[model samples]
Target: MIKHLRGVWISCLLILGVGPSAGWAGVDSDISSSRYPSIQAALDANPGKVVEVAPGIHEIHDTIRIVTAGGGLVGSGRIIQMDPARPIVRIDHASGATLRGLTLTRPEGRRETESEAVIATDTHDLALVDLRVIDNQTRGAAIELRNCVDGQIRNCLVQNYQRVAVDDRTATPDQGFAFRCIIGTGILIRECQGTLIQGNRVREDRLVATPEVKRQHGLGQIIKKNAVRGRIASQRDWDRGETDNWMQGTAIHVGSPETTDNTQVIGNLVERAGQGFDIHADHVILSQNIVNDALVGMKAMHGSKHVIVTGNQFIKNTLWSIGMMPGASSLPSRAAQGGQPARAANVDGGSIIANNIITDFGLGQTRWIWGEENVGCPIRFDHGQVPENPPLVDVIIQGNLVYDTGRDTLIKEGKPEVVPPRYRYAVLVESGPSAPVGLHFSNNLFHPGVRGISNIELKP
Candidate 1:
């Protein structure tokens, strides 16, 4: 068979050494310039080397710092281009690095803000493969693993990041795994530790803003300075003000809770953000993702624990398609603070919001749970003046499918009614008899289009 395909292409060109001279094996011992000229002089001419950055566009003007220690930094199909005015690569305290098939661009008239294209601080076992962070005016985050530890960002292609597109801060928020990124925010896990955000393609560009009017003159009309406020300021009048600027941000922004237990956001394909996955961290696991045109589609906040939102696919989100805020004070339990465990009470008893598919387009405001109150005293409060109602004790919302293209989908407001009494189930809650557990909403599937009350009762 053609001599075994020429002996498997000569053993993959002798395991990719393809010698005819191309430099990179501990930095330039030979192999005359095709564009090496600096990547920190090819890592200071091979310090703990294992280089191989061949292939085209290597512009870079500064910040390619790789304080090596033990091999691995391959970009065999190079294109590190960055000068987005200037500010590319910067792996200061490196340790076992491995950057493959690069292509990090930046120069669209570089603005500033610590102008970053790459910056892995306090590094440790790193691995950024198949990269391609383009555009870059001042934040096309292709990769920025700070205080790194065993890291790994796969198949990248983070685009136009004006703000956050893979910024793993790493004090240990699950450690790493950002697969298939195409067009920004597809990943932003803060503190780091075994994190994994799979299959990405976040899209943003739709928030629509500019339209407001209010006038009431039934029993209230006293502003006669030239009287002419007959209230005629319309964008079709009232119900057309939710589209704010498409691509508003966040296709993934897991902030960190001390490595939030084996976190994982699977199968992504979000669109037009203002919100599309902003999980806070703690044993999280969101599956089969595919959100569209978001104003808000998934916003689980602080104290996140043992969360598991499954089988996703929320389309046309003008607003609200799963939102849980849990976290106001207890100070992580009272004192642990930033690292965790002062009062450390989240994970409100095993959460499992299952099988999803929401489609709200009535112009926003679908679901929201604020919960906040933990700072010191008060034990518990959900706005109704303590009478034996503690607050979200456990959760589980099953079988989903809500399409409210027009008739407002669900809202439960909360406030200073004195505090203490939280229960709002939507379905299946055969009597826990205490008065505050509402929000169980069984079987789901509600889309008859509007009249105000697919589920709502909030006045505290």
Candidate 2:
């Protein structure tokens, strides 16, 4: 029966003018610089075809685009972006476009830019498999998918993605948060639905935010003099030139609260990031991920809802291992007493955080920034930006484990000390008008740091 179906599919492809041999024409055909004048020429010659690149470094001066439906590029080749302003590859409005087993990077001078290594926008069934995006420092993401549905970014590697970037949010003065510099991101899924981000590794190669490194890079001088400043986001750190380090990049981020939905982030590894996973969407399943040596292990906020976080391991995180809060877009103006809508209508809650493990809290790369001052927590439920925003509700925190190794950990390069667990509480629930509500905690095993399990008693 399977053979019959395969024959039928082959017949259908033949009827559609796609010969079976044509599909495999470029596979291992040595489409190198000698055969093809440029990679774009090879792609333009073969529309709707899968062109396999040979095993060598290929320089791309212009943006390589895959716009035709069912068109793609694959094979074991390294593409270095010589163009600083453009993405290495852009898949615009393409369906079933696949970029597999390719290494995308940029030269050192071209690294600091807003362009992503591979960006797929308005695509469907886009598969980015076994791709390596390395040493491409940008304020934006290394791999970005926007308005793409049913896409998969699997078995990919994003390394050293964080560059010191300006976090300019000065336009929205109503929020009272303004400009500061920050790091970049690894993989960003914006307004994407039913996306599967599995078996990927996002990591930093070097410590970019250290005092010496920051001085050498002139990290503090990157902020422009005319940049609007209402109130700095991290005021204390901003004064100390430490805001950029603390606000480093997320390894994986799912944003676009009103549009993004039903994302599965499974079995990924994140190391040495600002936030391991910054989730700002709804209906997300974050499972079996390992986040090591990050500022925050994971945070679901910015109007996120119905998120299920389970079976993840967070290790050596300086900030909260797990955090959920309402954001600026949490409530519509009509839903609140005196709320003014900012971007879109959304809310926070209906989330489940269960069976997760957190070890070596307050021992990440940002430990020097935060210090051992009881600054971190295993779990936290916090408030929104404004009092008028609706509170987070209906969250279940169950079966989690917070264990401390009680050993000497690395503070920084050549600084290893037995720093005690710098946690305020195992679980912290903030108290305010917009504090999280309807939170249920049960069967969580924890080792207390400064305070016990929680500041407020939770009902099991």
Judging by TM-score against the true structure, name the best candidate: 2
lDDT of 1 by residue, 207-289 (tens): 22212100111111111111121122222212332112223356567766545456677887766555678776677788998
Q: Global lDDT of each model?
A: 0.49, 0.81
Clashes counted in candidate 1 amount to 62
Q: Which stretches in model 1 have alpha-carbon errors above 4 Å? A: 1-36, 40-56, 59-65, 68-157, 160-185, 192-250, 259-275, 281-296, 301-315, 318-322, 325-343, 347-451
**What is the lDDT, from 0 to 100, of the residue 165 in candidate 2?**
54
lDDT of 2 by residue, 297-369 (tens): 9999878989999999999887688999887767753543456444455889999999999988876667776
Q: What does the lDDT come to for candidate 2?
A: 0.81
lDDT of 2 at 368: 70
Clashing pairs in 2: none
Off by over 4 Å in 2: 1-34, 174-180, 218-245, 333-345, 407-419
lDDT of 1 at 242: 17
